[model samples]
Target chain A: MPNFFDLNVHAYPETDVPVEDMYRIAKRYGYTGIAITNHDDTEKGKEILPPSISTFVFRGVEIRTKSVSELKRKIKLHYGEVPLLAVHGGSEVINEAALKDSRVDILAHPCGEKGEGELSHVLVRYAAKNGVAIDFNLNAIIHSRRSDRARILWKMRENLKLVRKYKAPAIISSNARFIYDLRAPREMIALASLFGMKKDEAIHALSAIPEGVLEHKWKKKTEVEII
Target chain B: MKNAKCKVQKSKYQFVFYILHFALLLPPSLRERKRYLVFEVISEREIDKRELLEEIRDSIYSLYGDVGASESRIWLIDYDKKKDVGILRCAHNKVEEVRAALACIHSVNEARIGMRVIKIAGTIKGATRLIEKSV
Candidate 1:
């Protein structure tokens, strides 16, 4: 088997590196796939991929909307026509927006410590009801602003308990913005366990959770089956 | 009304109670303030809510001199979990003293803690709308 899957990540957005680099570095580290998910442009993500690519590359995008209709519209505007897109973390406004929209695949770290985002049980339930997958950004929790680390830990713990309570599907990602930030599955699992994830659960969060979000593209059911 | 005061034997909870009762005794006119004694207990046995209140009245009358006044009140709560901790507060102190006196009795086990306190002030209109009640 290949290394554990990291569900969300990006190459250095600043340098505009060629598409082949994502395939090379990701495949180099035993990654089974790479989604050249950059910013909000689906066409731009497609443009970033090499025409000669052999590894799996999915089109992805992030959003900046603060309301549900806006997010659905944005998803419709970008991904409803395409195949896949990922939303960034923010406050209740963004969470509400993402969960209410049918097209959004994953709700990225809505509890990002830096954003001081409040993830309430209502939002968790709403996300669960709408089939929204919550994100656990291990990379950000490990390497974000130091002042809000405790707050992030508290929020993550609370949010995950509610997720488990509601049996909500969750996706774990590195939220890696740089090539260096990309992690092998073991590395990703270690980072996730830092915030109270069991080893198997962390694996499910990374591999199964992202796969859950992209199941339609893989022609599998949206349910991320855990062994 | 017997205002019998005694040093509770060595216990962390009693120390907490001592702090509470002393703070309660600090009104501008100790002569006019009615004494309300409440003992909160978390026992090894399953104590219902009403039993818990009766226990509070019993402990207060036995330990402290009880001068029963309508406004004088003692509320004893049986903590609903495994943790053996309870809080007692007297309401007779001056404005600032009463404010600080019962500050420690925030919640009982898993009971609705902060919101109930808010409701006492004729607030907590309803459960948080945008924010759901923590289950």
Candidate 2:
């Protein structure tokens, strides 16, 4: 069976949730692994994490940059250090830069604040070619209500439809800062369906896509060691 | 006065018998199919059953609207106070809708809470069995 993984969990220094509690709640929610992505500047580098019972913990960095050159520099600096590197996508420049770069594993929330300019077919096609998975964050859904939540969901559905059409990879993450924000794999799957994703596709987004990223990172690490 | 009292007693006994007869007479297809969802809530403080149900209902209503909420026929089957585990009953077809709503619920009465669905079963008995094993 393919194990489920959440690739963008924030805890400890980045968020109020302690690392131990994040791991505990994630495991309880049936996640086989969790990638704790903290801001790059917050901590020096990937520090030693506490031992988990069975859940595999992976270190990741969320890069927030202004210009293309800055984003590129951050990616090159952190690519070898962390198993996952996600770009915080809200600005048009950042979204384009992140999609075109193969080093960035995920473009976190492309439609977050940028309305219609969030993503286009050309951008999504480039993402497909570069193997950058667009993120569908669950935090917006969990935290918002009324008109705000509806707007977020509507924008996400548009992104989801385009991503599916372009045959680009899509991944779902809780992007949870608090333990309460975490959800079970099955629950995540159900929520994805509301945004035009199929059941099987949602399952793949949670498990297979993130697992592929992990495997790719593992290969890179081993190859470097051998050389 | 005596005759009136006897009639009232007979009518009460007849009402009970009538309800039992109708309940037995209902067709299997007419009965609502139920699905039990087992879940655990992790939060700062203990959550009461009343608040949990209200929050769940509100979420369902917000996401799916009033019609979907009514169609869901959501019910709290049972909850363990200390363990913070509960079994929720809903219409069979509305299980996914209910699950989605439950997943989106992050807080109850301003207290942050995390809910994890343990198992989903077609019967309350099966759901309870899964809960015992997991707990």
Candidate 3:
């Protein structure tokens, strides 16, 4: 089995559920590791990290902002502080801004949590160049029904097309606030299939891509090599 | 006359039993291929078997619609309420489809729940063995 990682989970102090509880459940679900990316607005100045769990639970922040400048500042503030830096993406400007920046790791739910936002091919190409992974939040599909779910699936299909064309890295995350929202990797692949993602592609999104994102494997090298 | 009447009734009953048995049996090659999924549920509160079954059926119907549901041939083999584990049978090829449907069932009677398939086996005995091993 490949080393599977879920890079977009939300735990305390963002929600009532504790980080340990989330870790235990995720471990049982066959995940190698999970990142607790609580929104920066909620976790401000509060140390949510528990010393007991280190390697299993990676500390991360999801920057949720409305303005491009503020988003930039927040990314600068949290860039080196955390192992993973995700941007809560919605609206055209935020998605474009997040994808354009190489420091930003994953763009969580670019189409908004409710499928209201959109992404273009140009933005996706930027993501590929910047090494930003476009996140497909499966929780939206889990929670919505009928028309709402249909719209989310359609938007995801569109995003998948763009990601494919641009060859941008893609990651699938539960975005789980509760333990119940977490799904096994196999089930995640099945849900992703609804949006026309192939089994191998979904597996890569769930495992290899998230791992690579965590290690900054795709980030472009800026410094010149000393010969 | 009573003895003759009894004999005739006995022969008629035997004929009906044979026909029923034959109707129930299918050639191995013609039998519908099935897979048994052993799953466990974690819920906010205890869920009744009937309620869980209803929720599963509803999820499948909603996700795949009537035609897909019929083609899936889903059946609940057994459920242990205390353990929160159960065995479900579905068409062999439709395991992934049914798995997606199971994942879609978020709640039953407003009691939030999460389900995961532990293992899949080709026969009920194999599924039961998996449950035993897990427990």
TM-score of chain A of 1: 0.83
lDDT of 1 by residue, A144-170 (tens): 434465577677888889899887778
Lowest-sum lDDT 10-residue window in model 3 chain B: B103-112
Per-residue lDDT over A18-120 for candidate 3, one digit per residue giving the tens place of the 0 to 100 score:
8888989898999999998999998745546667778889988999999999999999999899889999999999999999998999999999999999999
For each candidate, report its DockQ versus the true two-chain complex.
0.01, 0.74, 0.66
Show the lowest summed lDDT stretch of 10 residues, model 2 chain B: B22-31
> How many times do residue backbones clash in model 1?
3
Measured as a fraction from 0 to 1, the native contacts recovered by model 2 come to 0.90
**Top DockQ model:** 2
**Better TM-score candidate (1, 2):** 2
> Who wins the lDDT comparison?
3
A best-first ranking of the candidates according to their TM-score comes to 3, 2, 1
Candidate 1, position A213, lDDT: 69
lDDT by residue (B27-134, candidate 1, tens digit) is 666545432222222223544555444533542343223553223454442233333233333444422222212221222333312101111111112212111222
Give the DockQ ranking, best first: 2, 3, 1
TM-score of chain B for predicted candidate 2: 0.80
Q: List the residue pairs that clash in candidate 3.
A: none
| lDDT for each residue of candidate 2 in A1-227, tens digit (9 for 90 to 100) | 67999999887877666778888877777789999888776765345586653347788889976788988989999988877889988888889989988778888888774333378888999888777889998887877888878888888988888888888888999888888888989989889887778899999999998998777742355357669
